[model samples]
Target: MDDSIVFHGPLGELYSQVKAGKIKTALQGSHTRPCKFWTAMKILSGIKNAVVITHGPGGCAYGVKQAYKLTNCRNSGAPYEPVVSTNMDETKIVYGGEKELRSAIREVDGKYQPAVIFVATSCAAGIIGDNVDAIVDKARPEIKAEIMPIHCEGFAGEYRSGFDLVFRQIVKLMDRPTPERQRQLARSVNIVGSKLGPERTEVDTDVKELVRLIEGMGARIHSIIAGNCTLEEIKQAASVAVNCTLCLDIGYAIGTEMRDAFGTPLNSTILPYGIAATEKWLRGAAVHLGMEREAELLIQREYAAIKAELDEARRHLEGKRAIVEGHDAVKALSIAHMLESDFKMRPVIFNFHPWSTEARQTSIDYLLETGLDPEVLITKGTLKFGKYESMQQTERELLEYLGGVDPASTVYFGSSLSFPPVPLVDLNAILNRPRFGYRGALKVAKCIKTALDYAARPRSWLTKQIVFPPNSGGLSSAQSLTSKLAQNLPDCTVYAQRRKGRCMMN
Candidate 1:
C-alpha cells in the first residue's frame, strides 16, 4: 500500500503483469516506517575511524546506539564506535540546540579522536533547520578529525535513501589518487557495498572466497567499501582498477557513485551464491582485470574441493519443496535456482523484486534458463504478520498445490521477514556465518536437511496446541477484560483487536 515497487500475486497473471510493465525494480517494504536515521548511522558504523554524532534527542540516539551496539556485536569483534547524542530536550528544541551539537562534537572528538567525525542529523534537526554543514565547518579546524555532515532525516525516505546520503557523505572522504597510486589500479580492486555480521564477517563467507578468486588472478583487494576497513582503505577505493558489489541493495548505489566519481569500472552483478553464478561472477571480474585464466582455475579448484559435499547434501535435499522470501529479488531467485538445480528441490513460490521491468524480466529469464518457473510473489521489507489475512488465500492455494501435505512439512528459506506455515529455514537467523559460495551451498543443503527432519512432525500436533488460555474464549468486547488479562495467556496477542480480527477473517 505504501508505494509498492511491484506486486506479483501468484500464477499466470504474474507473467502478464510483468510483461505489462506493472512492476519495476525490487526490495524491502514500505518507505514510511521511519528508520532513515538508524540506517545512516549503521552505514557510518562500518567506517572504523568514524564517530557518529546524532543531532537529535536521547530517544532517537538511544535507538541508533542500540542498533550500533547490536551490529557491532555481530561485526568482526571490532570495538563499538562512539555514538554521541545531543539529547535535545523540549527546551533545546524550542530555543535551538546548535550549541549543544557543537559541544557534543567537541566532546566526542576529544574522547574518541577518530579519523573522521560523522554528524548525523535527525528529523528533529531537519525540522528545526539545524544547519549541520555550518556547524561542521565551524568545528572542522578545531578538531583533529575530518568532519562529515550527513543530512538524513528520519522522514527523508527509506533505508535505501539513507544509504545514498551516507555514501554521498563518504565520497567527501576520498583523497585524490597520486600518480603512484594511479599505477596501483592495475592490480588493485575495491569491494563496494560489503557489510559485516555479528557471528561471522561477510569476507569470511562471500568476500573471503571472492578475495581468493580475485587475488589468485593477480589482483589485490584495495578496499572493502563500507565493511571493516580503515579510512585509508576507503580513500584508496578511488584508485582501484575496478569495484565489485556483492549485495545489490546499497551496492548498486555505491558502485554507481564510485564509477561516476573515480572512473573505476564496476561489476554490479548478482552475488555468487551457487557454483555457476560464482563462476560467472569471478570470470566477469577476472575479464575486467585480464585474469580470466586465473578465475577459471580458481573456480575449478574450489568447485572440486566442495563438489563431493554438495552432492552428498543434494541427496538429502532432493525432491524437497520450498518457498523463498527476502529483500533482494535477485538474491532470492539465485538461492531458489540453487535449490532447484543442485539440491533438486522444487521451489513453488518466490517472493522477490527488481527495480526495473527489464531487471525483473532478466531475472525471470535467468530462472527459466536454470529450468525453474515457480509462482512468483514479490514483497518488500520485514514481513508484517499484521497482514496475515491477505496472505491466507495464497497460503491455502500453495497448500492445495502440495496435495494437502502438512504445511509444517514444507521448507522455507528466507530472512526473519517470512512466516510460512512450515519449518522455516530463516537465512537471517544464521548469525555465526553467511550463506555464500560452494561452502555456503553445502551449508544451505545441510540446513534444508535439518529443517526437513525437524518438520516431519504430525500436522495436527501444531493445530491442536492451544494459543490463548482456556478461558480466553472467542475474543469479544463482551468478555470481561479481566478474563483476557489472565497471566496464563500467550504474550503474542498484545494487539487483541487486530489478532482477533485476523483470526475471524481467516
Candidate 2:
C-alpha cells in the first residue's frame, strides 16, 4: 500500500536499517517465500546420479521438483532422476506419513539406483511430526545407495538456511585424512558454495574461468562441493589444503564448518568480479598453499592481456552513472565494484532487501576489505509483490526515477526486463559470458562499450512504442503496455503483448 522508495544509503547505513528492524518489518509472513524443503531439493538434485525423496504432499513434491529438478535438466546438462515423494495427503497429515516415506525412499533407490538418496522432509511432514530421521535411520543400512536424512522442519520458512544445511550435511560425508595425506593435499583445494552443481551459481563459462585461474597457479582442484563433483570427491574434499568459497553468502556457513571440522583453512572471500576482487581472490587462494609467486605471475599475464580492453572501456565509462538491480546484495555489490572501481563509473545498487544483505554478512565483509562503498536504493516494488508484478512496477519506477534524473548520462545494469530511458546492458549477453576473472574483465569492458555505443542511437522504435508512455519526456513519444496497465487492464495488456511476442520468455 505504501508504494514509495523505502530507503537508500551506504552499506553501513543499510546495516543500521537492519539493526533498526527494517528487515524484520519487511519480512513478516510465513508463506512470503518458498520453504527450505524446496531449496534443499534444488541443492541435492543437482548432484550427479542423485535422488531426492520428498516426504510431503503430492503438491509440495511436484512444485519443488518442477521448479528445481525438471527445469534444471537442461541447465545442468544432465538428466535428473524423477523426484520421488511420499505423497502425504489430508488423511496422512492427520495420522502420520512415515509408512509412505519409507516406501518412497526404498522404491527410489531400487528403481533409480542412484549414488546417493536424500530423504528430505517438507513443511507438511514437519507439521505432522513425521520422524523422517528415524525412518532414514531404519532404512539406511538396508538401502544400496548412500542414504542421508535431512531435517527440514527447523528450517521451514527461510530458503537460504536450506543451502547452509545441505552443504553441512555434505561435510558429514568427507573422510578425515592423516597428517601425511593433509601434507600431500597442499596443492589441492575444494571449491565450496556452489549448488549441487553449476546451474544455481555462476554460469558454466564463469565456473570454468575460475578453474582456469586456479589451474594456472598449478593448484589442483580437489573438487567443487557438489558442483559437477562425485561422492568420492566430496569424501576427499576434507583433506584438501584450503576451501575456496566462490560465493561467501552460501559458502561461509559450510566453509567455517569445514575449517572447524577438518582444520582446512577457509578463504571466506573469492567473489572476484572486478580487477581488484579477482586479484585479491587469486592471492587469497594462492597464499595459503605458498603458490603466491605463481599467482603473481598469472596476475601479471592477465593484466597484460586485459589492460588495453579495460582502458578503452574505462575511457568510455568513466564518470558515467550506473544503476544496478535484480541480483542479491552480494552479487549487486560485486557488479557495482566492477562498474565503479574497474570502469571509473558511479554506481547505485537497487532492490537488495535489507534482510538478505544482513543475513549474508560475508559479502559485506569483503566490500569492507576493499573499502568499496557505494549508494544503495530500495524501490517500493521490491517489497510490494512477487517476481512478475515487481518487474512491472520496477520498470515503471525505473522510468519515473530516470525521468527525474539525467537519463542520458545514466545506464541501467541489470535484468533486460527493464526498458528505462537509458542505455540497456543485458547482463546475460554472450559477450559477458565468462564474467569472472581477468579475461572476464575484458569481456565486461566490451559488453559495456557495446551498450554505450547502442545507447548513442535512438532505441528500437518498436521498444519505444511498447514500453514508454505516449508523449513521455526524454526518450519516447508513445503509450506503452505499462501505461495501459496503469488504467487497470493488465489482463488485456498481457494478452496483447504475448500475441506480439513482446512478453514471452526467450
Candidate 3:
C-alpha cells in the first residue's frame, strides 16, 4: 500500500486501529445525509397524520428527531408524530423487542392512519439481536398503509453505511416489478443518493436541476430515490431505465442493488461540487446514456454562466486561506480542490474523522493530487457540550499540540459548543447550502470569497483569551471588537458575528 494514499486525522486514528492491516483508510463517526431527512420530511409534510417511529434506543431516536428538527421541518407545524420506542429498556434489549416494536407500530398505525409509517432501527437493536426485518415482515400484512422498515442502525457502519441500509430497505419496498415485468420507459431514470430532506432549499434545487438535466437529455426521471419523493413516486421507481447515483457514499449500494433486481443500469459518478467537476459529472452521466451531445450543450451553457459569477468571486477571494471540518471526506476534498483549482485560494487544512480505510485513501489521493500535505490537516478534537470547565484539561492539551496557531483558528462543526474560544462554523449550514452543481459552485465561491475578505479585515481580539459571558444579550465584547474592526469592510458582518461566539449561523 502507498503510504501517501493514507491520510490520518482524529477520527482516522480510531479507524486505523480498528481495521489494523485489513484496510488502508476509514472515516470516523456517521456523517448525516441531507437527502434522507429531506425525503422523510417531504413525505411527512404532505400527510396530515404521519408517524416516524425510530425502532431503537433513546439516543438513536433522539438523533433522528434532532436531525429532523434541525432541518427546520418542525417549525412548519406539520402534523406528524415523531415517535420512539419507550420500552427499549434492559428487558427489551436482553430478550428481544419484536412484540413491543410490533405493538408500537400497530398502535401508531391505528392512531395516526398515516399515509406512510417508517420504522428505523438503531445500533442497540442491531447488537441485541433484534430481527427488524422479520418484525417488518410480520407487520406488513396487518398494516393498512405503507409501513417501510428502515434498517439504519448506527453500528451497521458509518453514516453512509446507514444511508445505504435505509435506502436499500426503501428500494426493496418500492421497486416492485410491473405486471408486464418490463423496463417501462427508456427515457426515464431514477435519481439516487440523497439522505437529507427537501427542507433545505439547496437539496430541492439539486433534485430539480437533476430532473431538468435528465429531461433535457430526452430522459425523464421515473422517480427520485428519496429527496422530495412520496410513497407513490417511490413505487414508480421500477419503471425507470437507469439509476443515477450521486453522492457516491449513499447511492452506490442502492444503485447496484437496483441494477441487479430491476435490470436498471446504474450510472455511478462523483457529485458535482465545483464548476469543472459539475460539468464532468453531468457529461459522464449523459455519455453513459448516449446523450453526450445534449449534455455538452447544457454543460456549455452552465459553464459560461457559472464562470461569469465565479470570476467576480475570484476577484475578492483570490489568495485567501481557509479551513474546513466535516465528516464527508469526498465533499471536503472536492471543496479543497475547488478552492485551489477554481478560486486560486488556499485551504490550510481539511479535517475529517477517519472510519474506513477506503475513505482515508480516497481523501489522501485527492489531497496529493491537489498538492496538499496530509500533515496540515487536523482531526480528532474533543467534541463536547455544556460548561467550558469540562473541556479545560483537553483544551490545554490541544493548545499545546496546536502550537503557533491561534486558538481561534480551530473550526467547530457539530451542535456541541463546549469548546473554548474557537471560530465556529455550523456544520449544518455548510452542508445545507445550495453548494452543489454549476450554479451552486459559483454561489459557494462567492460565499467563500465573502468569508475570506471578512477574515482579512483586522480585528482587535485575535487571541482566544476573550470569553463570552453566559447569555450576554446579543454580541459579546470580542464580537463587538471584531465587528467594529470589520464594520468598514464589505460583507464583514457575517465574520464579525460568527467570531464572537459559537452561535449557530445559517
Better of 2 and 3 by lDDT: 2
Give lDDT tens digits, candidate 3, residues 348-391.
43334444235445445444544544323433332222222123
Question: What's the count of clashing pairs in each model shown?
Answer: 14, 4, 30
Better of 1 and 3 by lDDT: 1
TM-score of 2: 0.85
By lDDT, the best candidate is: 2
What is candidate 1's lDDT per residue for 242-353, written digit by digit as tens? 7787765467777788778777788755556766666766776787787877777777887888888777767767776777763455667677767766677777554444
All candidates' lDDT scores?
A: 0.63, 0.72, 0.54
Candidate 1: residue 113 lDDT (0-100): 84
Clashing pairs in 2: 196-226, 469-478, 470-478, 470-479
Backbone clash total for model 2 is 4
Q: What tens-digit string does per-residue lDDT give for candidate 2 at 1-506?
A: 23567777787788777877765535534215556776677678667777878787778778877776776775656666678878888899899998888888778888889888888887788887887888888998898999898877535657788888898998898889778878878798888888744353445477778888899889988888767677888777888878888887888878999899888888877477878788878888888889989999999988998787678767878898998883456778788888878888899887677666656677776776778778887777666544522245666776766766654577777644356667666554342258888877776666666656545454445544555445544233222343333333211112222234231111
**Over 4 Å off, model 2:** 1-4, 22-25, 28-31, 76-79, 196-204, 386-393, 404-408, 461-506
TM-scores, each model vs. reference? 0.76, 0.85, 0.67
Tell me how far the alpha carbon of residue 71 in candidate 1 is from the true structure, in angstroms, after superposition: 4.2
